[model samples]
Target: MSRLDVTTSVPVFTRPLRSTCRGVPASEAPPLSSAASLVGQQVGHFRLLRELGRGSLGVVLLAEHALIQKRVAIQVLHAHVTQDPARVARFLQAARTLTLIQDAHIVSLYDLGMRDGRPFLIMEYLEGQSLAAFAKGPLAPALVVDLLTQVCDALGAAHAHGIAHGSLNPTSIFLVPDAKGRQHVKLLDFGIAGLLPPSEGAADSPVAADLFAVGVLGALLVTGRLPSRGHAAEEPLHGHAWEVPPLPSDLRSALSRVLLKAMARRPVDRYASAAGLRDALHASVALDGGAAPPESLGLERLPGWYALRGPPGVAPASR
Candidate 1:
C-alpha cells in the first residue's frame, strides 16, 4: 500500500469574506467587498450560513433556503474575477452548460443569480470526502472498479449532452454515502475548468482529454501512484506517452490491458467514449469471478471513510 501523490492543474474555488447587498441588481451593485461579511446575509432565496472554503476565483458558502429550510451550497465569484467581462461570460456559459446536464453521479444545480454584482450558483450540498482523500494507498480492486464505473457513468451522461467535464481530477470526484451506507460518486465542477485559459500543449479535444484523465485516475487507484511519474522514458506514442507501471499482482492481466488502452497517448488509441471504458471494466469483472458483491467491497474499512453525518465538528469542504 504505497502512498499516492495526486496532483492537478485544475483551478479550485473555496473560502469566505464579506460584502453587502440590498435589492441592487447584480449589474448595478458596487465594487465587491470581502465575502466573509455575507454570513447571515441573504442571497437570492437562501441565507448564507457559514464559509465552507474559498479559492482564487470564488468563495463557497453553506446556505439554507429561507422557506423550505433545505440546505444547499452557494458559489459566488470574487470581485477581482468579476472584473473581467470575458471571464464573467465564461462563468455564465458554464452555468448554462451545467443546467443541460442531469445525472445522479454529478452534482445538481438548483439556481443561478447575483449578489452585490457578483454571480452566484445554488447547488445541492453533498456530505462526503473526495476521492483524493482515499487515494493515499492502493484501494481494493473491487472498490477501484466500482468507483471507475460510476465516474464513467457520469462522464457518459455529460458526453451525450455534447459537453466535457474539462476537469476530471480526484478532488472533483466526491463520495456520498447512501442510506445503505454505500459510497456513491458525485462529480463536481464540470464546465468551470473551461473558464481558465488553455494549458500549453494541452489535449486538442476536450472529450479525448477527459478520457485521458479517467485513465490517469484508474492507474492511480490500482497502483497508488500515477503512471506518468518515476519511470524510464520510452519512445513517445502519438507525440506523447506516460510511463505506466504494471498493475498489482492480485489484479488480472486483462485489467492491466484495459488501463493501458485507456491511457494510450494517442486519442485515437484510447476508448472511444466513457461507455467503452465502462464496458471494458464490466467484461474484466465478468471474467474474474463476477463483480464483487457491493456489501463485501468494504469501502467503510478505508482509512478516512465517512458516513452521512460526516466527521464530527468539521465543516464539509467546498466543491
Candidate 2:
C-alpha cells in the first residue's frame, strides 16, 4: 500500500516564529528563570500544578483556582517569544477571542494575565484525546456525522462573531468525556486562529476555508488519511479517491457527496456556512438511525496523552 500522504500546516501564530523557533531549539533557549518556575506557585488565584503539554510556542499547565479549587489549563508563552511586540499582540488576541466566543463545543477562556513579561491564559482543562488519536482508524458513520455536526455548530458560532479558526486539524479537535462517560467534542487552540486572508475568489473567504478544513477532517475520520495534498486542479474535480476500508453500500453515496462537497477546491463550490454544512450532516445521519453520541458509544479506548495521568486533578480512565 502506498504510504498515505497527509498535508499539514503550522498554526498561523507559529508561522512568524518559524525561523527564530527553528534557530533556537528548546534546548538552546535559556532555561526558565527561578521566577518562571510556576509549579506549586500561584499566579493570581490559580495554583500551577504541573505541565501538560509543551511546544516551541508555549507550555500548557494544569492549574487549580486557589479560592474555588476549580481546575483549568494555562498556556504560558515561552520567555524568549515574549520579546516580539507583534507576536505578543496576536497571542493576546487569540486568548481574547476565546473569551469572547462562548460555545459548548469550544474551549472556554477563563482569564488572562501577565507574568514576568510573559502572558498566560487560563482555559478549560479537558480530560480526553484529540481527534488525532483516531486519525489512523475508520470511525463509525454515526460518530463521524456527530463530530461533524458539533464542529460545524462551533464554527458557525465563531464565524457569526467574526472569528475564524484559521487552523483546524485532528490535534486541535478534542474528544472530551463527561461524567457519564459519553464523549463530547470541543475545539481547542483558537488563540492563534484568525480570519482568512482575502483572495481573488470565494475560496479565499474565511468560512470557505473553515468548511474546507471540516471536509478534510471528515475525510480523515472516514478514510484514516487526508485527501491527497494538491490543488483541486491536480485531483478529480469532485473528490479524491479514498483508500480505506469500504463503507456499507447503503450510506456510501451520501457520505461521499458530503465529503466531496465540503472539501470542494473552490470556496464557491463548498457549503456557504458552517450551519449549512451541519444541516447536510444531519441529513446524512438521518439515513441510518444516527450514530450514538460520541460519549455514549464505547470507542476503542484512546491511547497516548488521554491515558496518561496528570497532577492531582481529573485523570482520564481507559474504557
Candidate 3:
C-alpha cells in the first residue's frame, strides 16, 4: 500500500485552535451551538460530527451541510502541513484529480475549498462498512471474485481518465449498503496518492501504484487480514494462516504471481497496467498461464458483462 505512493498511516484531522467559537462556555441547546465553541467545529458551512480516521497529513471527518442538510465526508489538511505549499497543492490536487473521474464505484468528490486556512476535500457520505469489516468474517470465494471483478471495472474506468487509485486496499473499499443491506463494494478515498499524473505525459505513468494495491486487496480478501506494517507477507503466501477466504480456487496462484509481478523488487517487472492483471483474473488462469483482455470485454466502455455476472456459481451470459 505504501509503495502505491499512498501514505502508510491512518487519516488525521485538525481545526484551528484559536477561533473564538472554540473553547467557549458550554451550554446545551444543541450539539451544534455548544460544539461550535470547540476547536474544529463547523468547517465553513458544514457541521462537523466526529473524526473518521487519520494519517500522515490530515484527518477525515463525517460532516453535514448546514443548509442542504446533506451528509458528506471531508478530508481536512493539518495546519502543520499547510505551512508547506507543496503539500497544500497536493491536497488540492486530490480534489481536482477526482473531479476528472465520473465512476459510480469510486467515491464521488463533491466540493473543494479551505476551512481555517486548511484545505478540505468534500465527498459523498457513503453509508456502509469497509472491506475491513467484510474480511473480519468469512467471505465466500465467489463473492471475492465478484468484488474483485467490480474493482477491476472501477480501476478500469479511472485509468481511462488517466487517474490511478493509488491506494486500493480494504480500508479504501466500502461496502455501500443497498436498500436490502446486501454488500456492494464502492471504492473510496483517493486522498494520499494519485495513480496517474495531472498532465498527459510520462511523469504520471507509474501504474504499479494501483496494480500493487489491487493485489494487496485481493490477498487480504483471501487471507482476511493485512500484513504487518513494514513486514513482507511471506508466511501466508508460502502457506501458514488457518483461514483463507474463498475466491476462484486457482485464483490464489494467479494472485501470488500477479502480486509478485506487481510488487517486483524492481517496478519494471510489474504488469504494464492494472488491466493486464484483471485480464488474467477473468480467464481464471493459473500462475504462469496468460490471457488477454477479451475482445468482447473492451475497456472502452463499462463492461456489459456484469449481466452475465449472475449469482456466484452461474455461468456468465456468453463464453
Candidate 4:
C-alpha cells in the first residue's frame, strides 16, 4: 500500500544499518541466540522493540523510530529463505507492488532494505487482531456486511492494478480500531501472497481467487465456523459449503444470496469483478428501502409507467 499523509507528528528518519551483532563473537550471533538478539537493536532507522510474531519465513518485530518514536512493524526474512534467489525476488517484487498500490485499506509498505544479508520490510503499525481472533463466533449481520464491503474496495483496487492477493485468509485480514469505536479493515501480507504464480483459467485467475477467498471469509464471519463435512466437532473446517448461520429476518435472504454467489465454485458464476460485488452489496443494504430487485436474481423490469409526453418542441397529445 502507498503512504497517506496522515500525520503522526513524528520526524521520519532514514533507517541506518546498526546490527546488534556488532562487537559480538561470530559464534554468538543472533542466529545462535534464536534471533532474539535483534531485540533492543537499531535496524535501519527503527529500533527493534520486541518480537511481534514469527512466521515460517520471517520474523515481525514491533519497532520504533529512534528520533521520532513512531512505531512500525518490521518483517525480516529468515536467512534460509533469503538464500533462495527466486524467493528473494518475489519478496522484493511484493514490496514494490504494495508501494505502487497505495490503497487505503491495504497495509502500507513504508520501506524495504537488507540487514546482514537478510531482507526486511517496514510497514505501518496497525493495532488490532486478525479476523482469526473472532473465529469462535459469528459476527452480526450489519457488522459482516460492513466488513465485506470495505474488503471488496481494497480487493478491487488491487485487481485494478493487476495485483493478485493469492491468499485471502482470516489471519491476513486485520481489524484495526481507530480512536472511535468503529473498526477498520487492513489487508496484510500482500508480498507473501504474491510469491505464487497466477493460476490459469477464469476460475483460477487472481481476481477470481481473491473473490473466492472473500466468499470464504464472509461465510466464516457469519457462521463462526466454516462449512464443514460430517466430521468430529473438534476438527477444523475441511470442506467448502455455502452454509451460513441464520441471520436476522431482515438480512437473511439478501445476504445469503450475495454470499452464496460469491462462493460459487465457478469463477464465471461469481461477480465479474470486486466492483460488481460492491454494487451488489450496496443494493442489498438498501433492499428494505423498496429499491429494484437484486441484480443477482437476473431480474430486469422495463418501466411500466413511461411518460406519454410528446417529443420536445412538439405539443403533448390530447388523451
Best by TM-score: 1
Candidate order by TM-score, decreasing, is 1, 4, 2, 3
lDDT of 3 by residue, 1-319 (tens): 1111122122211122122122212231123222224235666666777666555555666676678676556665556767767756765775666566666666555565664556666555544444554344333344455567677667776777666665455555655434433455566655545322232212324355566556556656555454423223212121122123334444446555554454444546666665676675664533435432322221122222111121111000110
Per-residue CA lDDT of candidate 1, range 1-319, in tens?
A: 0011223111122211112111324653323366678788776556888877665567777877777786767677778777877778777776766566667676545666665557776666655555665455666566777788898888888888777777666566766656655567767766556555564445547777777777767776777653232221111111134444567766666677787888776878888888888889878787776755765563444443221222221011111
TM-score of each: 0.77, 0.70, 0.60, 0.71
Better of 2 and 3 by lDDT: 2
lDDT of 4 by residue, 1-319 (tens): 2111111211111222233212223332233234488898766566778876665566677778767787776667777767777878887887666666656677655666655666666665654555554334555555666678888888887777777667665555655545433456677666664443333332476677777667667766666563221222211111232333453344467777788788777878988788888777666767634333222111121232111111111011111
Score each candidate by Cα lDDT.
0.61, 0.56, 0.48, 0.56
lDDT of 3: 0.48
Off by over 4 Å in 4: 1-34, 196-203, 226-251, 288-319
- Give the better candidate number (2 or 3) by TM-score: 2
Candidate scoring better on TM-score of 1 and 2: 1
Runs in model 3 with CA error above 4 Å? 1-45, 49-55, 180-182, 194-205, 227-270, 285-319
Query: Would you give me the overall lDDT of model 1?
Result: 0.61
Q: Give residue 110's error in model 3 in angstroms.
A: 1.1
Model 4 superposed RMSD (Cα): 14.4
Clash totals, every prediction: 13, 3, 15, 5
Candidate 4, residue 188: lDDT = 66
